[model samples]
Target: MTYVKDQSFKQDSLEISIAEPKDYFALLKPRVMYLVVLTALAGIMTAPGHVHGLIGFVSLLAIAVGAGASGALNMWYDADIDAIMTRTRTRPVPSGRITGDQALAFGLILSFASVFTLGLVANWLAASLLAFTIFFYAVIYTMWLKRWTPQNIVIGGAAGAFPPIVGCAAASGSITWDSVILFTIIFLWTPPHFWALAILKSQDYEEAGVPMMPNAKGLDRTRLEILIYSLLLAPVGVLPWLFGFASPVYGVLSIVSGLGFVALAWRVFQRRTGKPADSAAKGLFAYSILYLFLLFGVLVIETAGALILNRLG
Candidate 1:
């Protein structure tokens, strides 16, 4: 499918949009938003302070909206490239279900609303961090790094890693080492997790002129880098347990999951051709998502349980 540079005639022809609620919601990139909410919740619950239920709920809602705003803006700005890539060609803006102007307006409104709401309900530190995250993703990453460099995912990963820090600030009005560690885990996890998918989607990226690792660097280099990052991620993933913030249960689960992540990365690194290689990359991609979800999910559960037990005691 080809993307037309000028949508003026098409816009005049349509006059009325055929978009539905789900089409607009699709612009929010809900899957990524879910991960942001989960990691942020873990940060909020694990931080060393008591946050009132209503305040906590509002803070989380504001953070979610901020994340959604980032997603919308990213889609708006990347519509041309999105139209070129098979995986993203059907996205709301690229598919003409939502106009770029509408998406920009929606994203800008949500960005302002989320930041202002968080500042009023929580603290300004959290609000500031949320605002920065949106700007970094929409402007710095989406507009610049993504098309300019192969390290796009590596550097751009910072935007995705900020949610937990924002949550910690909202809950305690300060950034703790615990929240930083949460940020670190996600930061380290991003390269391998995304590079694995990049290995699989190299052609799509090449066609779209996005400088993803596998497209810019050779696949062998990307695979090796994926393994290296996976190795780093495994040990760091165990830090919360080692530091005593999380229980032994989390420690054991983290070790097991971390090992599994490395094993998948190794598989990707070893398989160098054809269907076997593609399958390996796909396995690593899928397992990487599960690996992160398990770690944060278990951390939240363990931390919340400990808090409840402490209050009872």
Candidate 2:
């Protein structure tokens, strides 16, 4: 009877110790990771030289892991506020599926492993950039700027913009104007994209005490700021073509998409009350995602097509 009781206790303990794999995956913030991978691929493809298949694969994997590590750390650190916000209450750390300690450990371990692997397979410059990116997002953005200032997303946007630069460095062992252009485009795109969502979720941010633009500066101010960023982003989005890396097709697509972004922002700026306002913000937020994906997708497609043509020639 004693032996059976002990065996049952051990089994229960073992089961309790195991967490669901999907919960762990959620800590990685896979949606954010997907964007990181896409921008990083564009960086690699647009760089000046060819990368070996194995090296390119390894570098991208390392960057993805590093981005995941940053996400995990962000979730761990923000778990307290996350629980207070409706938008984030269901995340792994806040939902009771993952403990803070577990997330911190997971993030730290992955951060070290990714930087080391990237340095081994690519150049240290790329690895160092990845390390800085993780640190910036986890420490600077999450621990400091996010709660302290309304301009958090503006400054913290650099972390998201670094992936392309890292990818470019990994492929060419150096940063170039092309990579900087990619970085600039994403950096400019972040504020308008996030501010649009902030308009819709300002109440959640206020309750959580996060100083998002809409909460800190009022909805009117946030709307104006979004419009301004969209205007700036329009011309910057066309830079790759002007720099000679992208074709006229990309230029035309960028101009048209940029105009659409500005138009959406203008609607958000004009609609200031009730369902109209919410719908406009929602529309801008959704279109911002599509706009970014379209621009980067075109760049990747053009690069791939050129490479194929050269191979056949």
lDDT of each: 0.94, 0.95
lDDT, residue 294, candidate 2: 96
Instruction: Candidate 2: list runs displaced more than 4 Å.
Output: 1-15
Candidate with top lDDT is 2
User: Where's the lowest-lDDT run of ten residues in candidate 1?
Assistant: 6-15
Please report, as a residue range, the 10-residue window in candidate 2 with the lowest summed lDDT: 8-17
Q: Candidate 1, which segments miss by more than 4 Å at Cα?
A: 1-14
Q: What is the TM-score of each candidate against the true structure?
A: 0.95, 0.95
Cα lDDT tens digits for candidate 2, 1-313: 3455344354544424356899989899999999999999999999988999789989999999999999999999999999999889999888888889999999999999999999999999999999999999999999999999999999999999999999999999999999999999999999999999999999999999999999998999999999999999999999999999999999999999999999999999999999999999999999999998999999999999999999999
RMSD of 2: 2.7
Model 1 TM: 0.95
